[model samples]
Target: MTERSYNSLLSTGRIAGLELSNRVFLPAMDMNLCVEGEISDGEIAHYTARAAGGTAMVITGTGAVAWPVGATSRHQPAFSDDRFIPGIRRLADSVHAAGGRLCMQLCHHGKTASVDTADGRPQLVPSLLEGGADMSALRDNPMDELMRLATATHGKKATYKVADEDDLAWVVDQFAAAARRVKAAGVDAIEIHAAHGYLLSSFLSRTYNKRDDRWGGSIENRARLTCEVVRAVKATVGREYPVIVRVNGHEYGAADGLTAAETAEAAAMIQAAGADAIHVSANAHNPFADFTDGPLPNTVAAYREHTKTIKRAVTIPVVAVGRMLPEVADEMIAAGECDFVSMGRQLLADPDLVNKIRAGERRSVRPCINCYVCVEQNFFDGNPKCAVNPALCNEKVAVLTPIARAQHVVVIGGGPGGMEAARVAATRGAKVTLIEKGGRLGGTMWFSQLTTPANAMLVDWLTHEIERLDVDVLTNTVADVELVASLRPDVVIVATGARRGRPAIPGAEMPHVLTGDGLRAVITGDADADLGSIGGLGRVAVGVGRAIGLLNDADRIRRLSKVWMPVGRRVVVIGGGLVGLELAEYLAERGRLVTVLEEGKHLGLPMAMPRRWTAVRKAAEHGVTLVREATPVSISKVAVRYRVGGDEFEVRGDSVVIASEVCADTSFADQLAARGLNVKVVGDAANVGYIEGAMHSAHEVAREL
Candidate 1:
């Protein structure tokens, strides 16, 4: 086999006093695996997997340097005292044993600290902003339960006690002691969390810091606290120990915050303060700032320019991190943009990405869809998880163990759930055959690919793995009781996916109205043989769709959707769930005036908050009208009549699309069970949760087999 070319990123590198195996760094991301401020075994396993996967270095997620007063989460690891040293030591040793160097990120949440965690204690800020928790960087998060509770404490504003001169000194000392404790625990480096509008970042922020003391005012004065913390850390850990400073390349949320130019100047000052390396990250309070949404092309390498700008201003190695792809990171390094690349969600999606790239199997590496499930789930008190990779944080629970007796498995359906079931069973030494009634393996996922480009990438990955495993894949083949009995399979998995339900409305059967799946089938030439259901205008839509000349190919559909959407000049999408909201964005972007009618109080149900917020925001930006709590009563050829609070309103549109709930089909599994054969149901066939649910359910059922 020929060696894979990733020379720029795979080259050995040095940061401060430590020599790294590669230029890739796993940037700090909170896993919420700690128990009562102590590192749990789950957290250790989480880090160890990444280390063993061959990442050059790992930065442990943000740990509190000042507990209670500056805690970001109740479960966040702490290094404020000597008591945390033992747990820190075990974590360090595990990473070291796995052939990876580990660094501890020391942080003080400051003004952004959770009010619930602060309890009756005063939340510390650089200056006492009037809003306190209401004005906190974390206040924008819609998924944070703690933030919701804190926001609910109305009447009186969330209290804040501005850090005085004594408090600043005390914080500096706390950081210095944390650095000393980490050094004692054999940590390779200590990264001061000075980004993300945290305590130190609030002081650095021109938008937040209004202090006129030595620690605030000018750029030099505002950055003084961060510089002092860096100096204090170096003094305790010694000049030779590597200390990384994570600074924002651009604070998008702050109106007067540091731009690239200001950030470069700040970076130069940080290096001058004896810091070893600069880890460049961006976004202050915006939840969507860190993880860019997938589907669009512009979000690729979103933060490389920031790193390139800062690299020229400082002598220390700059680590650039954004929604960077492996090839993009390599090219950025080759172009001398930055010395290292840091991956957060990418690593979570597949820790073995580096290993796969090294083995010339880069195509097999799972991609991070940038769905923001990790950040969304974490803030909701759940451990981080990847939509594509089900075994992300729940590594121990999702492990695939070999069965005592290898049996023949027949999986009905070629969707994500079925594909995953086949892959797992085959890997566990079972003879597997996957049958799909559709011509393709991806069920509704092909339609999903049209909405989000990353979902198309996921289909590519899933199909490739199924093929690589040598599983028998039979497309256009329906599985019934007779077929399974002929094969005499010991186990049968039915993942026959979900179907979009039709609502009972006056014009529901009108030819002008189309189901979301019907629209997809028309686009891909997978429509039913009967053209009558589409109506007279529907035939025109199909003809125009066929003229685009796309088959089952997702890439072509995606390219076509960008320029040519099948909808009319005016479109109204009913049911503003994930599919409806996404389709509205898709239609509106193609010059169609779109309106989304949802019965639910919110758009994008079942989707995580970050993704929902992003999709809804993008739809609004594209001029897509959203009407919540609107029940569709009937549809006319030229308009849609929906009711809200006993008031009927008509939305004029040329075309109406039904993007409603999907119902699971368990008839296949039920029939198989009746025949006295072992049967399992997964994915939409069992429950309709889209990708995350499908993959997770598949993994769970397949593991048992």
Candidate 2:
């Protein structure tokens, strides 16, 4: 085969005094892979995997610049003292051995630092203000001056001692000291964390900093602390070591927030003050901030637009983030919109993304679905976990290499689990066959893809993997006892999936109503003939009928309403999972008065925290009324009956949509068992979990097989 010639992202790349092998960089991500401010063997292995996979420059997770005051969590690593040097040294050495450059990100959480990690230290800031400090940064003061600022409020301790000029200087000095330590650890470069509303970012935004001093006036004033810190670190580390600043190009909500031009000005000041480059991202503190979307949100292309503006304004290289794909990165670099690409969650999904591109194995690259599990994990789960990459935060575990003895594997159901099993088994040199009752792969995901744009990536990723591994797919073929007996494999994996159970309520047999699966069939034009008897059959109704329950049907109503009753002017969605909430938002956007009623105490309980918050906020913003702690007792033609707080209430709606409860398919499992073949259920087949669980289960089962 002819060698493919391409511009190397690693070769001839230099930022500040440190040289990089490529333009691809692993942006800082909170993996929670560290062990008590130290790098664990898993952290080492995880990073080493990325380096070995061919990342030119790997930036370690955020390292605290100031011990207790700056650290966000107990699991985060610290670069404040010589004690951390050995672990960092090993990380840098490992990257170097893999022919990759390594950079350490010096971070200070500021008000975001949790009190647990602060060890009773006060979370100080430029000003003591509301929304300025939370429980995460609350600190106890022993000093008389600081003690006076402590107040008991709402059964909690609140401190109001603002950080004076002296305090600011001390923080800057701590950052400089941390930088020097990182350099001493033999790391190639240092990146300052000024994004994500951290201490430096809080100072840069007017929303967080309300001081009337020089640091609180204009954009220049707000940016003064950042510039000072950059200069101090540069001076402390000497001229040769590279220093980069990671900053948000836009703060998203604050009207007085820094704009692209102001961000450029700050970047220029940092560069002139000895900074090497600017890693540009967006502020996601506000629900409205564009960056608050998932890692690979559908609007990623729009996010990349801001990078172009910042790149044009700055002289130093600009590292652009915000769900950038390899092709997108190439285009941005080729267009001079960004000098390098920084990917946080994308790297977590596939550390070898760059290598896969270089090897022309793009199909093998795992795509981030932008579900926000990683972010949710960092915030609520106390660790970062990727939905697509189970080994992401737990890279300390041994990578499962192919077993010496390969077994013939039978994977039932062509969803994520089955596909993953087949792919991994095939990779291990096992003979694999993936069987799906439907004519295509992506079982329940097919329905989800229809309703949500973010979920479309799931279908794409699964299909890519199935094809790349050359899994023998037998679609539209039900796996029965005769079939399994004929195939007779060493291991049978039953991902047969689940089915919608009979609704144990009155009107459950209503022809007008539909299950999630039935709705999906209606929306996707795959409705079984059984649904044909529903009244009000017309083009519009049929179209909607065809797309009834598919998750991604942006136009199901429009397509079917012409023949059927136009999607009722008023709509009510039951359940508050990702599907229910998203459908409510979609319908509300289309001018429908939407109401969502959930039986849970909180809306979006089924979803992970941060993502659930994001979805709930979006639904509320779209004028969708969410009724939590309410159970729908009955759905009538004119109103939805529900019980909340032991009180009965009714919501009027023309059309009622059921968004809760997914039925798992278990026929294949029963059939496999009847055949006396060893079978293991995974994904939605075992229980209704997210794609991450399914893929992880599949991978685990494949290893055993």
Candidate 3:
């Protein structure tokens, strides 16, 4: 019940003359929940949840300044016409009633306007599409995923129209008109979308704005159009309307892009043009691969370095927008780095993030595992759906109604899925018991902290919730029909995770080789049973780790593993999918030479597109060799031989780890079912869904129960 302090983050703040309740702002992230440029009721509900959750300011996703002419999708709301005002008004009123201010981000999708492409109209741009977009990452994309996007596009391709003076005039006029509509609709403020690779931002990119006219060339000229739009928006909305300009703090993966210096200069110009505040964001030129580098970066404080520069350059308040965690945002504000922070993905991960922070239950604020699952839908012009929070798009899912009658619930695993089922069911008045086979609560999730550290936050939060709910938890115990029968549970939720085993291959049983569970066992000192799989050195490492009690702390194990892991200098991983690729990169970072062999053409098939691209890019940067279409033929103590096409080659390795050969495990569920027990299976046990699938599946079944 102790309170956590984040004074600066929770303090009241002002933009222009408008006072907000707190410094936390929800920056514009497209949910694509609009109907032909009009806000849908679903979109309003999504915003209202966040607003009621206690976010001081909630900004709508980009709304087209000129409707279909300047939209990227039919679902993008429009502010150009009066007909869209009613939807805007409803949204504003709802957010206001929920005790939060609302801001509309006015946008005009320029060269990237797919809606224009679909309608056979040229997308307006500062200049024609030229070069500098690095799309090499697209090669790694699965053909089926790419083809689906093509199919969604209705077979139309983008055509561009370089803007002339009149076209520029029209663009500026549209923005002004849009702001007028927003202000009249009772929105608290206006945010002009001049960031990302959108219309106004295209003018700022030196590579794209090749025009010799006033709208292009020098920094001032390149910024002229954006500044003009800011001035027009300010003029239209009146001087004290709290206008914010979202400008790219930096652009990645493109030549002649908005450098840090250029961005600072542009911020000054926008300020001079009467923008009340600056909303700093970064952009990646290549949408395919570089998307994670900006707009939706995977890194923490993704825009902080650039945001600091712009904050120093401008007298106005600066809002930092990339993955702004509460603690980081609070520290940044205290350090005078920025005035406000936008918790975009964090908001999606947990709508009540602000409420949790206000209640001093910061640890209870579910952390976004930095998985790109939410933004992945944007590639297909689809609405945002959070992997961690199933209630994101549908706010009602988190509201657990009481069960019809009092019932005892037995959750047969302590993994995320099992834990979630117990939490939800217990919250709904069910007496719950969580049973785990391992000594600890988190299963693969606890071990996953070694590579993806963010996952540890979720494990910690769920463990805290499990404890807070007073759910009976039994660890270091095996589940069986007898156990459930003893509990006499009315409902049994089985989340026993995935089934994994050693792959059958030449020399597969070599002492130097480790299977997935074998590696985990060695790390956790559970290798007493799997000692045959690891070499003598690994066995010694495990004993020493457990003797010193290092195996009990996942974080300690992760940190010490970097310096002294039992693995060899040269390691080969047997799968190029999510687990294998991430493990390879993690090992490479710790100074181990790593190689990953995949029988398939692509790596990380089911991982979200942005994360998949980033993993592939970073693995290469870390000197990890990824061999596609390579099927392992044999494994020796010294090397792993694999075949790519007709030729076979060997990758030298001191240790080989098999990160593949996993399947769904429903044995326990089947056993319980045979005993006439009311059973529902979830997580990897039912199907190989990993964490996201586990959460969703558990929530679905638990809700029904």
Candidate models: Cα lDDT each: 0.80, 0.71, 0.87
Model 1 residue 278 CA deviation (Å) reads: 0.4
For each candidate in turn, give its C-alpha RMSD to the true structure in angstroms. 3.2, 5.6, 1.7
Task: For model 1, state the Cα shift of residue 204 in Å.
Answer: 1.0
Per-model TM-score versus the true fold: 0.94, 0.89, 0.97
Pairs in steric clash, model 3: none
Cα TM-score of candidate 2: 0.89
Across 1-705, the per-residue lDDT of candidate 3 in tens digits comes to: 557699999999999889999999889988988988889988999999999999999998888888888787788778878988898999999999999999989889898787788888988888776454577877778777787566435668777888888988999999999999999999999899888988889898886788887777899999999899988888888887899999999899876788777899999999999999999999987877688889888788988999999998999999998888988999999999999999999999988988888888898887899888988788878888887899987887868999999999999999899998998898888999999988788788877877888898889989998898899999878888997889999999999999887778889888778887788886677633366666677788888887888888877887787778788899999989889998999899889999999889999886899899888999999999999999999998899999999999999999898888888999989999999999999999999988899999999999998
Per-residue lDDT of model 1, residues 54-94, tens digit only = 89999988888976558867677888789989999999999
Ranking by TM-score: 3, 1, 2
Best first by lDDT, ranked: 3, 1, 2
Which candidate leads the pack in TM-score? 3
In model 1, which runs have C-alpha deviations exceeding 4 angstroms?
A: 1-3, 115-117, 130-157, 286-298, 527-532, 535-549
lDDT over C-alpha atoms for residue 518 of model 2: 55
